[model samples]
Target: MAKKAVCIMSGGMDSTLAAYMLRAQGYEIVAVHFNYDQRTQQKELESFRAITARLGTGQTYEIDLDFFAAIGASALTDRSIDVPTGGIEAGVPVTYVPFRNGIFLSIAAAIAEKEGASVIGIGVVEEDSSGYPDCREAYIEAMQRAVNLGTRDETQLTIAMPLVHLKKEQIVAEALAYDVPLELTWSCYSDEAAACGVCDSCRLRLKGFELAGIPDPIPYRVKNGVS
Candidate 1:
């Protein structure tokens, strides 16, 4: 039987590329997406479905956690905390969903155990990220240990973070090399209709494309001098 990998896809370029890489390594993919009442929930779900179709993977899961909205800590989940559009700041931004990756990995661990999968792939880019504590490699590694300790004795799982140390430019180059459908992915922290070019997410993405010498395919509300 072919080895299976449960990929935690967020419908962004990074996650999509990670899933594609896993598939390239000869693992049957089990794509998983979480909808935690984020600002761009609909857009993300649409992208996830399109990515799954492009991958031609039959097994997929879309889990909704409404508690995020109730908790209301992060800018993505709370309406009051405006998403920073000025630029990438010095510390953990308001957009950092509280303990989001940890929660997602925990659920992915359960899915991996149920599916008898050996690997769980998550797209976490720490080098160019917004300093979210949950995106740190050490935290993820600790989570992996805790997950294994909590799971059945026979079930062993490795949490794969392919983009942990890569910068956004490198990720863009890698995604292009893999022929990932970049146009289908969404990275805007605010505004679902068109990307707000000033947001941290958009800035990083545009910078990546610029550094890669590749024009971004998605439309942005403000160009902000990004070619």
Candidate 2:
């Protein structure tokens, strides 16, 4: 039987590409998208729906959590805090949502247990994460151990982070090689229909495409503004 893989799709470039990569590797994919009430939730969710439909090899599962907004200390979920400008070299930036990945991973693991998936795919990376403690390799490993121990005799959950050690450009290159639908993924943290190219996330995405020598197909208001 083909191994089952549950991909956590945030509708971002890395996660979307991870889905395609796993699908190409012959793992049966089941995408789980969590609506964490983030600022880009609507955009990401819509794009995820379309991209999964286009892939045609997996089922999309949506989980909603309004509670995330109430505990929102991060700029991604709360408009009150500003998204820190430039690279966050000092430490984990305010954009780091509290226990965000932990919550997501736990939920994903539970879903994997119920679905009997052998592997759980996450798109966390090193370069773009800056200093987010939860995005590091150590955190991933620890989480994996916890999940395995918690579900040992019942279900096997292998946390797979293919992009964990790769740079943004490397991820983009891999995505292009896999023919991922980049146009269907949303990276900007803004609410506009078209991506706001100035945010930290968008800027990093733009740079990644540039370094990867790939033309980003996503529509942007800056590149095609109303005249």
Q: What RMSD, rounded to one decimal, does every model reach?
A: 1.3, 2.3
* Global lDDT of each candidate: 0.91, 0.83
Query: 74-152 in candidate 1: lDDT tens per residue?
Result: 9999999999888888998999998899999999999999999999999998888788898889998999999999999
Clashing pairs in 1: none
Q: How many backbone clashes does candidate 2 have?
A: 0
User: Which runs in model 2 stand beyond 4 Å of their true positions?
Assistant: 85-89, 152-154, 223-227
What's the TM-score of each model vs. the native? Answer: 0.97, 0.92
Model 2: how far is 38 from its true place, Å?
0.8
lDDT of 2: 0.83
lDDT of 1 at 4: 93
